[model samples]
Target chain A: MLKIEEYRQIIDEQIQMLGGMKRPEGLYDPVRYILSLGGKRLRPVLCLASASLFGEYSAALMPALGIEVFHNFTLLHDDIMDQSDVRRNHPTVHKKWDNNTAILSGDAMLIKAYELISKSPVGVLPQVLEVFNKTAIEVCEGQQFDMEFEKTSDVTEEGYLDMIRLKTAVLIGGSMKIGGILGGGSLRDCALLYKFGLDIGMAFQLQDDWLDVFGDQETFGKKIGSDILNNKKTFLLISALNRLEKASKKELLHWINRKEYEAHEKINAVTRLFQEAGVSEVLIQKRDDYFTRSLENLGKINGDHEMKQEIENFVHKLMARSR
Target chain B: MLKIEEYRQIIDEQIQMLGGMKRPEGLYDPVRYILSLGGKRLRPVLCLASASLFGEYSAALMPALGIEVFHNFTLLHDDIMDQSDVRRNHPTVHKKWDNNTAILSGDAMLIKAYELISKSPVGVLPQVLEVFNKTAIEVCEGQQFDMEFEKTSDVTEEGYLDMIRLKTAVLIGGSMKIGGILGGGSLRDCALLYKFGLDIGMAFQLQDDWLDVFGDQETFGKKIGSDILNNKKTFLLISALNRLEKASKKELLHWINRKEYEAHEKINAVTRLFQEAGVSEVLIQKRDDYFTRSLENLGKINGDHEMKQEIENFVHKLMARSR
Candidate 1:
C-alpha cells in the first residue's frame, strides 16, 4: 500500500494536469488559478488511501481527481459568497478576476469534475455518481444552513453539528466510499469505511473549531478567534451559549451584537466566556469521542491488517494537526 | 407519439416533483420559484420528441428532466451574471432573494439535474454522461465568450457564431442527442440528430437576433430593440460591420462608441445601417440555409418515416414563430 504522502503526490500531479487546460482564458484561467492555490488535498488523498486499503489505488485516481476538483469548485464559489479576499495567502478567483468569472469557471470545474468521475469503471459508475450527486446536494444544503445560521441566533448544537456533517463530513465520507467502490471493496466494507471517514471528518471539523480559538497562532496559520470575531456559530459557540449562566450568556450576546468593538476585545471577551463556561472541555471531549468512534469504525473494515493500521496511524497524524 | 404539449406537460410534472423536496427552504425555494416562472421547456421537449422518433419516449423521461433542470440551472446563473431583473416577467432568483441564494440554489439544481440524468439505463449511461458533460462545458465556455465579447471589440462574425453555438445550440443538440441515445437510436442516427438540432438551434438564435430589431414589440414580448440598446454583438451587427463600405463602417463604429444616445435613435440608426448593408437579408438567408440544412440532416435519419415527418413539421412550426 502507498504511504499517505505517495497518495497526496498523485493527487497534486493530477491537479496540475487539470490546471493545464489553456483555452477560453476567461473561463479556465480561474480554474487553473484556484487549483494552483493548493490546500492539503485531504479529501482525494483519503480517497486514494481508502482505495489502497482494499485494492489497486491507481483505479481511484480519476475519481480522486474528481473529488479534488469538486472541492475546489465549492471553495471558489464559497469564497465569492463569503466575500473572502484571500485564500491560501493569495487573492481568490473572484477577487483576482470577478464574480462572473468565478461563477462560470466554478460551473465549468464542476462539469469537469463530473467528466473525471465518469471515468470510474462502468460497473461502479452509477453507484459512484449516486453518492456524488447526493453529497453535492447536501453540501449546497449545508452552505444554505450555514448562511441561515448567520442571521439566526437560537441555533442549536444539534443543528450546528448537522450543518457541519452535511457541509464537510459527507464529502469526506463520500470520497472514501467512492474510493472503496472503485477499489473493488465489497459494499459492506465500503459502508464501514464510509462511517470511519465520516467520524474522522466530524472530529477534524470540531478540531478546526477548537483550534480557531485555542491553538498556537504560528501553527494554526490563521488568526485565532477569527470565527469568534465574526460571531460564527461554531460548536464551541453553541455549546457556550447553551451552557452559560444568565450574565455570561448576556455578555456573549452583547459582544455578538456589538458593531464597534475592537477585534481583539471581542475575540478575547468571547474566548473568556467560552472558557468560563467550560465549553473548551466539552468540545475536546466531543471531538475525542468522534475520533475514537472513527477508529472503531476503521477496526471493523475487512481489509489488510497492515494497511488498516497504516490508515489508523494516518488518522492519528491528521487529528493531531495543531491547526 | 406525444404532442409537443404533452411532452411539455411531462417535463412540467417532473419539474414539479423536483421542487417538492421541501427541506432547506432557502435552497429549494428559489429553485421552485425559478422553475415555476416558466419558459418554453424547449430542451426537454425536444429531447422527448427526438426520443419518441426512435423508440419509447418514456425511456427518456428522466434524462429529459435532467436537461430541463440543467437549462434552468444555466438561466439561473446567467441571470445572476447578466443582472437580469426579470424572467418570465417575474423577479429573477438573485433579484428576488439574493446573489448567495441564487448561486447556492443554482448549484443544487445542477446536482439535481445530474441525479436525474444518472437514471439513464445502465447500458448507455456513460455515453449519455459523456455527451451531457461535454455539452455542459461548452455552454459555460459559450457564456464566458459572451461576457468576454462585452469588453472585446475585435470579435469577428465567426467568433460570435461560435459563441452562440456553444451558449445555445449545443444544449439543443445535446438534448436531442441524449434523447436519441436513451430511446435506443443507432449511434449514427443520434449523431445525425445532434447535427440537426445544432443547425436548427443556430437558425433559431439568428432569428431571435433578427426579431430583436424587426419584430413588433407586442409580438416579441420584449422591447423591440433591447439588444441594440444593450450594444449586444448580434449577427446583424457583425454582418453590417463586415459588409459595409469604409465610410459606412466608420459611421457604425462611431455609433457603437457613443457613450450616450437616445435608445430609439441608436436602434433606428443601427437598423438603417443593417438595411443599407443588406445585412438583414444576409442574416435571413443564412438562417434559412441552416433551416434547410437541419431538414436535410433530419431526412438522413433512418427513423420511422411518419415520425421524421412530424419532426419536420414541428421544425417548420418552430421556425415560423415571428417573435
Candidate 2:
C-alpha cells in the first residue's frame, strides 16, 4: 500500500512539472498562482489510488495530474461565474485579477490539462483521452444544469440528484475510473471503482448540505445554517418545502421571502422548522444510505486486500472529518 | 489541390459531424444556434488547402473542423466577456441564452475540439494534440493581451501585432500546420505552411481593420467604423496616434476621449484624419507586405507545381474578395 504522503508528493511534483513551461508573460502567472493555492488534491489522489490498485502508482501520476489541472481549470472559471470573493481563504483569481484574465487563464488551464494527458505513453493515451473527454463534457453539462437551477422552480429531487451527479460526482467517478483504466484494471473493475467514487461523492455532497445547517461552527470551518440565509436550495430545504404542513410552509416562505431579515435569526428559525419537519433526519438517512452503498461498491472491487484496506481507511477518514 | 467547392463540402460535412451530438437540455442549444449561423469557413478552407498541398485534402477535413470548433468556442466566451450583442448578424450566444450558458457551452465546444482531434488515428493523435494545445493556449494568451490593452493607454504597434498574432493568426496558422502534419508533410514543410498561414492571417486581419473603417457600407457586411465608435485600438488608429502632429493629436484625443458623440460625425472625422495622415496607406503597405511574405513562404514549400498553383490561386481569391 502506498503512503498518502507519497501520493501527495507525486501530485505536487507532477503539477510543478506540468506548469513548468514557457507561458506568455501575464497569462501563465495566473495559472501558476491558482495551482499554487492548492486544495485537498482529492480528485488526483483518487486517480493515483485507483491506479495503484492494479499497477505502479508512479505510472498514473501524469494522468492524475491531468485530472487535477482540469479540476482547477473548472474552479478558476467557476469562481468568475459565481462572483466568488475568496477560494481556499485566498482571493479568487478573478477577484485579485480581472474577469478577463481569469477567463483566459482558465482557458489556458484546460489546454494545459490536455497537454499533460497527451504526454502519457502511447499505449494508454487513447483510452486516457477518451475518458478525459467524456468527463470534461459531463462537467460542462453539470455546470449548465447548475445555472438552470437558479432560474427554475419546482426542481424535483431526482432532477437535483442528476444535476449534482453530472456537476460533481461524475468527475470524481471519472477520475477513479481513469486511474483504473491507466493501471490496466479490468473494465468491470474500473466500472465498479467508478460507481464507488460516484456514490461516495453523492454522500459527500449530502454531508456538505447537512453541515450547512447542522454542523458545529468551529469544527465545520464555516458558519452553520448559512444556506438558509442565502436562500440556497439544499436537500433539507427542498424536502422541508415539499413536506411541511400549510402553516409551516407559510412560515418558511416568510423567511425566504424576506430580503433583509437578520441572517442568524432567519437561519435559526429555518433550522427549527427544518428539524420540526423531519427534513434533517431524512437527509441524514439519505446520506448514510449513499455512504453505505459506496462502501458496498468499494468492497466488491478485486484488488490486493492490504491496498483495499488502506483505501477504505482513507475513505473512512474522509467521511469522519468535520470540515 | 482540391476545388474550392470540394473543400467547402468537406468542411461543411465535418462541421456537421462535430456539432452532431445532442446538447443536454437547456445547455448547449444556444451555442449550436450561434455556430449554425454560419460564416465563410475560411480558416478550415485554408487548413484543407495547406494539407492538400502535400497529400489528400480529405485527410485534413477533421483537423480543419477542429480549428473551426475552437474558433467558435472562443467566440462564445468572448461574446460574454466583451458583452457583445450580435455575431454574424445574429444574437450572440450569451445574449440569446445567458452568460452562464454561453460560458459552459463554449467550454463544451473546447472539449469537443479535443474529442475531434483525439478521433485522429493513434499515429497522429499526439502531434495533433500538441499543436492543438499550443494553439489553444496562445489564443487565450492573445485574448488576455487584448483585455490588458483595454485598460492601458500605452499599447505599441509591436504589442498590437503580438496580441493579434496570438488571438487570430496562430489559430489560423495552427489549423494549416495541423492539416499539413496530418497530410504527411515533412516537419520542415509543416513549419513553412504554418508561417505562410500566419503571415496571411496577419494580412487578413489588417484588411479586416481597414474594412472596419473604410469598407463600403454594403460590401463590408457590418457597420462601418464600428471599431472607432467603440474606441478599439486598431493598427491604423494606433499609427495615426503615433504620427499625428500636435493639432491632429488633440483632435484625435477629443474624438477618443469623448464619452458620447454622433456616430457618423465621429467616424467621418476620424477616418478623414486617418487618411490625411497617410495611416491608411501605411497600413495598406504593411498588409501587402504580409501577403507578399506569405506567398514567398508558400513558394518555398516542396510540392507539386499544379497543387501549389491551385493553392496559390485560392489565396489570391481570398485576398481579392471584398467581404
Candidate 3:
C-alpha cells in the first residue's frame, strides 16, 4: 500500500511533467506560471490516492490533474472577483497581468480542464462529467452566495455552512468519487468516499477560518487576522457575531467599519473579542465534529485496513497543518 | 425533408423552452435575459439541419441547444473583453448588469453548456465532447490572437484567417460534426460536413466584416462602419495596407492613430481608401471563394441530393441575409 505522501509525490511529479509548454505566449504562459506556484497539490493528491486504493495510480493521473487545473481556474476568476491581489504567497494572475488576461486565461484553463478530464476511460467519463459539472456550478453558486453574504448583515451559520459545502466540499467529494469510479471501486465505495471527502473538506475549511485568527505567521505563511481586516464573513466572525452581546457586537462592527485603524491593534482587539465570546472554542468543536465524521466515513469503506489507515493519517496530517 | 426554417423553428422553440428558470437571480436572470436576446440561432439550426439529414431532429436538439449556449457564453465574455457596450441591438450583459455579474454568469453559462452537451447520446458523447473541447479551446486562442493583433501593426491575411478559423470556423465545424455524429452519419460524412461548415463559417465571418463597412444600417440592424470607428483590422483594412503607396499608407495610419477624430470622417476616409486600394473588390472575391469551397464540400458529402440542396439553399439564404 502506498502512503499518502507517496501519492502526493506522484501527483507533484506528474504536475511538474505537465509543465513546460510553449506558444500562445499570452495564454499558455499564465497557465504555466500559476501551475508552477505549487499550492500543496492536495486535490490531485486526493484523486490519485483514492484511485490507488482500488486500481493503478497511472489511470487517475489525467483526471487528477484535471481536478487541479479546475481548482486553479476558479482561483484565477475568484481573485478578480474578490480583487484579491495575492494568492499562495505570490501575486495573483490578475495582479501580475491585467484583468482581461486573468479573465481570458481563466476561460482557457476551464476549457483545458474539460479536455484533460475527457481523457477518462469512456466507461467513466459520463459520470465524471456529471460530477465535474455539478461541482463546477455549485462552486459558482457558492461564490455568489459568498458575495451576497458580504453585504447582508444577517448571515446565519446554516447559510455559511451550505455556502462552504457548495463552494468547497462538493469539489473535494467529486474529486474522490471520480478517482473511485476510474479505479473500478464499487458504487457504495464511491459514495462513502464522497461523504468522507465532503466532511473532511468541511473541517478543513473551518480550520482555515480558525487559523486566520489564531494561526502563527511563520506557520500559516500569511498575516494572521487578515480576514478581520477584509471583513470576510468567516465561520469565526459569524460565530462571534452570534455569540457577542450588543456592546461587544457594536465594538466589533466598529473595528470592521473603520477605514484606517492600525492593523495589529485591530487584529488583537478582534482576537480578544472572539476569545471572550468563546466563538473560537465553538469553532474548534464544530471542526472536530466534521473531522470525526470524515474518519468514521473513511472507516466504513470496505478496503484494505492498511490503505484506509494511510488515508486516515493523511486526513489528520492535513488538519494538523498550520498553513 | 425538413428545411432550414423547420430547423430554425425547432431551435427557437428549444431556446424558448430553455427559458423560465428561478434562483440565484443575479446569476441565472442574466443568462435568461441574454439567451432571450436571440442572435441568428444559426449554430443550433445547423446542428439540427445536419442531424435531420440522417437522424431525427429530436435526437440532435439537446446538443444543438448546447452549441447555442456555448456560442452565447463566448459572446458574454467577449463583450466584457472588448468593452463593447452593445450587442444584438441590446445592451450587452456587462452593460446591463456589470462586469462581475457578466463574468460569473458567463462562467455558469459555460458550465450549463457542458451539462447540455453531456446529454449527447452516450454512444456519440466522446466524439461530441472531443469536438466541443477542441473548438472551445481554439476559440479562446483565436480571441487571444485577436487581442494581440490589436496591439501589433503587421498582422497578415494568413494570420487573421487562422485566428478567425480558430475563433469562428472551428465551432461552426464542430457543431455540424456533432449533429452528424448524433444523426448517425459515418465518420467520413461527419468530417466532410465539418469542412463544409468551416468554409461557410469563414465566409460568414468575412461577410460580417464586409457588412460592417458597406452594410445598410436598417438592413444590417447595426451601425455601418462601426468596425472602422473601432479601428477593427478587417480584411478591407489589411488588404488596403498591403496595396497602398507609402504616402497612402501614412495617411491611412493617420486616421487609425488619431485619438480624437470625428467618427464619420474617419470612417469615410478609411472607406474611400479601401475603395481606392481595391480591397473591397478583393474581399468580395475572397468571400466568394470561401462560399464556393463550402458549397463544393457540401456537394461531396454522401447524403441524398435533395437534402444536400436544401442545406445548400440554407447556406445561400444565410449569406444573403442583410443582418
Candidate 4:
C-alpha cells in the first residue's frame, strides 16, 4: 500500500508548481495564501490510493492534484458565501482580502484545476474531463440545495442525504473514480470504487454531525451542541424532530425558536432530549451501516488480500481519529 | 458567410440543452430567464463566422455555444457583484432573485459551459479544453485586476487596457480560435484569427466606454454617462487624469473624492474635463487603431479570397452598428 505521507508530499509539490507564476501583484497571492493553510488532503489521497489499487499510483498524481485544486477552489468560494471568518485556523480569503478578490481568486483556482486536469496523459483526458464536468455541476447543484434548505421548512432526511451526496460525497467519489480510470481499471470496478468512497463520505459526514453534539471538548475542536445553537438541520436533529412525541416536538421547537439562550443550559437540554429520543443511537446505527456498506463494496474489488488489508488498516486509522 | 440567424438558433438551442432536467427550482430559472431575454449573440456569431472562413460553420456550433454560455455566466455573476439593476431592459438575475441564488446559478452555468465544451467532437476536445482553460483563467485575472483597481490610485491607461484585454477580450479570442481549430484551420491561421478577435474585442469594449458617455439616448438603450456617475475607471477618465493640467486634475480629484454628488452635475463636469484634456479624442483614436489592427490581422490569415472577403464584410457590418 502507498504511504499517506508520499501522497501528501506529491500533492503539496504539485500545488506549489501550480501556484508558481508571477501574477499581477495582488491577484494570485490570495490563492497562495489560501492553499497554504492546509487540511488533511483527503480527496487527492483517495485519488492516489484508488489508482494504486489498479496500477502505478504515480499515474494518478496529475489528476489527483487537479482534485485538490478544485476542492480548494470550492472552499474559497464557499467561504465567501458562508461568510466564514476562519479556515484552517487562518482568516479566510474573503476575510483577509475582500469578496471580489475571493470571487476572482476562486474563479482562477477553478480554471487552474481544469488546466491541470487537461494535462493528464492523452489516453485518459477525455473520459476524465467528462466525469469532472459532471462532478463539477453536481457540486454546484448540491450547494444550491443547501442554500435552499436554509429558507425551506420541509426538508427531509432523504433530501439532505442526496444533497450531501452531491455536494461532498460525489467529489470524493469522483477523486477515486478519476484515479481508477487513469489506473486502467474496468468501468465496473471504477463505479464500485466511486460508490465505496461515497458511502465512506456519508459516514464521515455523519460522524461530524455526532461530534458537533456529543464530542469531547478538547478533541472535537468545537463546542458541544454547536449545531443546535445554529439551528442546523443535521441528521440527528431532523430525525429527532420527525420521531419525537408531540410534547417533545414542541419543546424542541421552543428551543429552536429562541434566538438567545444560555449555551451550557441549551446544550444540556438538547443533549438530554436527544438521548431520550434515541436520535444519538439512530445516527450511530446509520453511520455504521454506511461504513459497512463501503467496506462491502471495497471487498468486491479484485485485488491482492495484502493490498486490501493495507487499505482497510488505513481506513481504520482514519476512522479512529477524534478530530 | 454564414447567416447570423443560423448561428443564433444553434447557440440558443445548445444553451437550452445545457439547462437539463435536474435544474434546481428557483436557482436556474433566473439564469435561463435572463439568457432568454436575449441580446445580439455577437460573440457566438463571430465564432461561427471565423470557423466558416475555413470550413462549414456548423462545425463550430458546440464551441461557439460554449463561449456564449460562459459569457452569460460571467454576466450573471458580474451583475451580482456590481449590484446592477437591469440587463437588456429587464431586471438582472440578482435583482429578480437574490444574490446567493444568482451566485449559485452562475456557478452552475459555468459548470454547464465546461460540460458543453467537453462534449465537443473527439478530435477537437483537447484543444478546446486547453483554450477554454486558459481563457477562463485570464478572465478571472481580468476580474481580479478590475477589483484591485477600485482600491488603487495609479490606474494607468495601459493598466486598464491590460485588465480589459483579460476581462473582456481573451474569451472572444478563444471563441474564434476554438472555432478555427474545429473548422480545420492551420495552427498559424488559428493564431491569427484569435489575434484578430482579441483586437476587435478591445475596440468593442472601447466603443462601450464611448457609448456610456456620448452615445445617443435612443440608440444606446441604456442610461447615458452611467459610468461617469458610478466613477468607473474608463479609458477617457484615466487618460484625462494622466494628461490634465494640475488645476483640472485637482478639480477632477475633488469630484472623484466626493462620494455623494448630483448625478447630472458630476457627469457634465467629468465629460467637460475629459473633452478639455483631449481624452475623448485619444480614446476614439485608440478604438480606431484597434479596429484597423484587427482588420489587418484578419487580412493576414491564409485563406480563400472569398472567405476573407466574407469575414471582412462581416467585420465592417459589426463596426457600423451603433450599439
Candidate 5:
C-alpha cells in the first residue's frame, strides 16, 4: 500500500506537470504563481490515497488537481476580500499584481478547475460534477457565513461548526468521495469514505483552532493568538464565550471590543481567559471525539486491510502533530 | 417555425423559473438581483434558435440558461472591474450590494452555470462541457486583453479584433455550438452554426461601436459618444488614426492625448476626423461583410428551412436596428 507521503509526492509532481497555460501572461502567471506556493496538499493527497484504497489512484489525478485549483482560486479571491497582503511568506496575487489581476486570474483558475474535473471518465462524469458543484457552492456559502460572523457579535458554536462544515469540511469530504467513485469503490464504500472524510475534516479544523493558541508558532506556521487579535470567531472563542463566568466574560468582551492594544498583552489576556473558562480542555475533547468518529468510519469501510491501516496511520500522524 | 420573439419568451420563462438558491441571502440575493436586471437575452435566444434549427429546442433550454448565466456572471465581475455604477438603468451589483458580495455571488453564479450546463444529456454532456469551458476561458482572456488595451496605444485593428473574438464572439459561437450539439445536429452542422454565430457576434460588437457615436441617445439606451469621452479604442478611432492626413492625425492625437478637454468638443472633433477619414463608411462596410458571411454560414446549414430563415430574419432585425 502506498503511504500518505507517496500520495502527496504524486500530487506535487502532477501539479508541477500542469502546463500549456502559456498565453495571456497577465492571466496565467498568477495561476502558476499561486499553485507554486507549496502547502500540505491535504485534499488532493486524501483523494489519491482514498482512490488507491479501492483501485488505481492514477485516475484520480485530474480530479484531485481540480480540487486543489479550486481551493487556491478561493484563496486568491479571499485574500483580496480580506485585504490580506501576505500568504505563505510572499505577497498575495492582488498585492503583487493588482486587485483586478487577482479577480480576473482567479476567475480563469476557476474555469481551469472545471476543465480539469471534466476529464473524469464519461461514465461517472455526471456524479462527479454533482459532488463538485455542490461543494463549490457550499464553499462560497461558508465564506459568506464567515464574513457575516465577523460582524455578528452573537455567533453560536453550532453556527460556527455549520459554517466550517460548509466552508472546509464538505470540500474535503467531496474530494474523497470523488476519488472513491473514480477508484471503482461501491456506493456504500464511497458513503463510508465521505463520512470518514467529513469527520476528519471537522477534527482537522478544530485542531486548527487549537493550534492557533496552544501550538508553537514555528510548528503552526502562523503567529499564536493571531485569531484572537483579529477577534476571529473560532471553535475555542465560541466555546470560551459560552463557558466563561460573568466577570471573565466581561473582561474577554472588553479585550475583543478594544480598538487598540499591545499585541502580546491582548494575546496573553485572551489566552488566560480561555484557560479560565476551561474551553481549551473542552476543545481538546471535541477534537478527539471527531478524530475517534473519523476512525470509526474508516474502520468500517470494507477495503483492503493494508490500505485501511495506511489511512489510519496517516490520520494518527496528522492528529499527533504537536508543537 | 418559432420566431426569435418566441425563443426569447421561452428564455425569459426559464430564467424566471430558476429557484432553490435560498440560503445565505447575503450571497444569493445579489445573484437574484443581477439576474432580475434584464438585458436582450440575445445569447440564450440565439442558443434556442440554433437548437430549433437541428432538433428539439427544449433539450437546449438548460444549456441556454447556462450561457446566459455565464454571460451575466462576466458582467457582474466586469462592473466591479470597470467601476461602473449603473447597468440596465439600475445600480450595478457592486454598487447595490458591495464588491465582496458581487465577487462571491458572481462565483456562485458561475458554478450555477456549470450545474445548469451539466444537465445536458449523457450522450452530449462531454461535448457541451468542452465548448462551454473553452468559451469561458476565452472570455477571461478577452477581458484581460481588454484591460491591457486600455493602457496600451498603437493597438492594431487585427489585435483588437482578436480580443473581441475572445471576449465576445467565442461565447456567442460556443452558445450556438452547444445548442446544436444538444439538439442532435451533425458535427458539420454544428461547426457551421458556430461560424454563423461568430460572424454575427463580430458584427454585433462593431455595430455597438458605431452606435456609441452615431446612435441616438434615447434609442441606443446609452449616452451618445460616451466611448469617445472615455477615450475608448473602437474601429473608427483606430481606422481614423491610420487613415487621417498628417495635420488631421496630429489634431486627433491632440484630443486623444489630452487629459482634460470638453467632452462635447472632443466628441465633435473625433467625430469629424472619423467622417473625414471615411472610416465610418469603412466600419459600415466591415460590419456588413461580417453580416454577409454570417448569412453564408446560415444558408449552408442542412436543417429546417423555416428555422434557418428565422435565424436569418433575427440577424436581419438585429443588424437593421439604427437610431
Candidate 6:
C-alpha cells in the first residue's frame, strides 16, 4: 500500500501527463492555468488512498485525476457565478480572462472530466458514469439551491445543511466511491466509503464556515469575514439566525443589512453577536458530530486497518487545516 | 424503415418523456421553457432516421432524444454568449431568466444530455460516449474559434470553413455516427454516414448564411441582413474578403463600416456589390458542391435507397430556403 504522500505524488504526476494543453490558447490556457495553481489536491489523493487500500494505487491513477479535474471544473464555474476575484490568492479565471472565456473553458473542463473517467475499467464504466453523472447533476442542483437561498429569507438550518451536502459532500463521497470501485472493493465497502466521505465532507465545509469567521488571515490566504461581508448564508450565519433571540436576530440583521459599513466593524459586530448567541458553539458541536460520524463510517469499511489508518491520518491533516 | 414524419414524431414524444421539470423553479423552469420553444428538432431526428436504417429505431429513441437535448443545450449556452435576445421568436433563456439562471440551467441541460445518451444499448455505450465527448469538446473549440474570429481580421476562407465544420458540422456528423453505432451498422457505414452528415451539415450552415441576407423574413422568422448588421464573420463575408479586388474590397468595407446608414440602402448596396463580385454565384456553387458531395456520401452508406432518399428529401427541404 502506498503512503498518503505517495498517493498525492502519483496523482500530481498523472495530472501532468493527461495532455490537452495545446492550441486554441483561449480554450486551454485557462484550463492549464487553473490546474497549475496547485491547490491542496485533496480529492484526488483521497481517491488514490482508497484505491491503494484494496488494489494497486497505480491502477486508479487516471480515475483519480478525473476526480481532481471535475473538482476544479466546479470551482471554475463557481468562481464565475460568485464573481469571485481571487482563488488560491491569485486572480480567478473570470478575472484573468473574461467571463465568456471562463464560461467556455469551464464547459470544456466539465466535458474533459467526463472524458478522463471514460477510460474506467470496461466492466465498471457504467457504474462509474452513473456515479459521475449523478454527482454532476446534483452539484448543479446544489449550486442552484445556493443561489436560490440568496434570494430567500426563509432558509432553515436543515435546508442549508442539505445544500452543502449536495454542493460539496456528494462529489467527495462520489470520488471515494469511484476510487473504491476502481480498487475492486465490494459494493458494500464502496457504499461505506461514500458515507465516510460524505460525513467528512460535511465536516470539511462546516470547518470552512468556521474558519471564515475565525481563521488566521495569513494562514487562510484571504481576509477573514469576506463571507460575512458578502452575506453568504454559511452555517455560522444560518445557525446564528436559528439560535439568536428576536433582539439579537434584529441586531445581526442590522449589521448584515449595512451595505457600506466599515468592513472590520461589520465583521466584528457580527462575530460578537454570533458568540453571544452561542452560534460558534453550535457550529463546533455539529461539525464534531459529523467528524465523529465520518470516523465511525470509516471504521466500518472492510479494508486493512493500516491502510484505513493512513486514510484517517489524511482526513485529519485536511480537517485540521487553518489555511 | 420509417418515414420522415414518423421519425420526427418519435423524437418529440421521447423528449416529453425525459422528465426533470421540478422545483428550484429558477433552474428547471427555463429548461422546460426553452425545450417548449422547440425548433426543427433536426439533430435528434437525424439520429432516429439513421438508426431506423439498420435496426430498431424504437431502441434508439432515448439516445435520439439525447441528441436533441444536447443540441438545445448548445443553443442555450450560445444564446448567452452571443447576447442573442431571441430564439425561435421567443426570448432567449438569458432574457427570459437571468444570465446566471441561463448559465446554470444550460449546464444542467448539458449534464442531462449526457444522462440521456448514457442509456445507450450496453454493447454500444462506450462508442456512444466517445462520439458524444469528442463532439462536445470540438463544439467548444468551434465556439472558441468563432469567438476568436470576431477579434481576428485575417480570417481565411479555409479557416472560416474549418470553424463552421467544428462548430456546426461535427455535431451533425456525430449524431448520425451515434445513431449508426446504435443501429449496429458496420463501422464503414457509420463512417460514411458521418461524412454524409458533415457535407450536408456544411451545406445547411452555408444556406443559413445565404438566407440571413437573402431569405424571406416571414418564412425565416427573422429580419434579413441581421448577420450583416451584427458584423457576423459568416461564410459570405469571409468569401467576399477572399475574392474581392482591393478597390472593391475597400468599397464593401466602406459600406460595412458605416454605423448608421439607411438599413435598406446599405442592404441593397451590399447585395449589388456582392452580385458585381459574383459572390452570390460563388456561394451557390460551393453550397451545391457540398450538397452533391453529401448525396454521394449518403449513397455509399449501406442502407436501403428508400431510407437514403428520405434523408435526401429532408436535406433538400432545408436547403431550398430563400436565396
- Best-fitting candidate, measured by DockQ? 1
Model 1 per-residue lDDT at A46: 87
For the second chain, the TM-scores of the candidates in order are 0.96, 0.95, 0.96, 0.94, 0.96, 0.96
Please report how far candidate 2 places residue B288 from its true position, in Å: 2.0
**In candidate 2, what are the lDDT values of residues B1-323, reduced to their tens digit?**
35766887777766665555764756667656766888878788877777777788776776678788889999888887888999988889878777767777788888988887787678887888888888888888888788778777688888888999999999889988888888889999999989998998899888989989978778677889899999898998888888889899889989999988899999999999898789888888989999999999999998757767877887787777664
Q: Candidate 6 on A91-172: residue-level lDDT in tens?
A: 9999999888988998888888888888787788888888888998888899999999988878899999999999999998
Ranking by lDDT: 1, 5, 3, 6, 2, 4
TM-score of chain A of 6: 0.96
Query: Which prediction has more favorable DockQ, 1 or 5?
Result: 1
Residue A258's C-alpha lDDT in candidate 1?
A: 90
Q: What tens-digit string does per-residue lDDT give for candidate 5 at A146-253? A: 989888878888899999999999988999999999888999989999999988999999998999999988767788888999888999898888888899999999
lDDT, residue A188, candidate 4: 91
Model 5, B296: alpha-carbon shift in Å? 0.2
Residue B58, model 5: lDDT of 89
DockQ of each: 0.89, 0.66, 0.81, 0.70, 0.87, 0.76
List lDDT for all candidates, in order: 0.90, 0.83, 0.87, 0.82, 0.90, 0.86
Of the two candidates 3 and 6, the one with more favorable lDDT, higher being better, is 3
Model 4: per-residue Cα lDDT over A6-113, one tens digit each: 787888877777677577747789988888887889999888888877888887887788889889988888887777898888999989988767776777777778
Q: Model 1, residue B8: displacement in angstroms? A: 1.7
lDDT of 1 by residue, A126-179 (tens): 999998999899999989999998887888888999999999999999999999
Better of 2 and 6 by lDDT: 6
Candidate 1 colliding pairs, count = 0
User: Which docking category, incorrect, acceptable, medium or high, applies to candidate 6?
Assistant: medium
What ranges in model 3 sit over 4 Å off? A20-22, B20-22
Models sorted by DockQ, best on top: 1, 5, 3, 6, 4, 2
lDDT of 1 by residue, B24-94 (tens): 89899998998888888889988988898878889899999999889999999999999999888899999
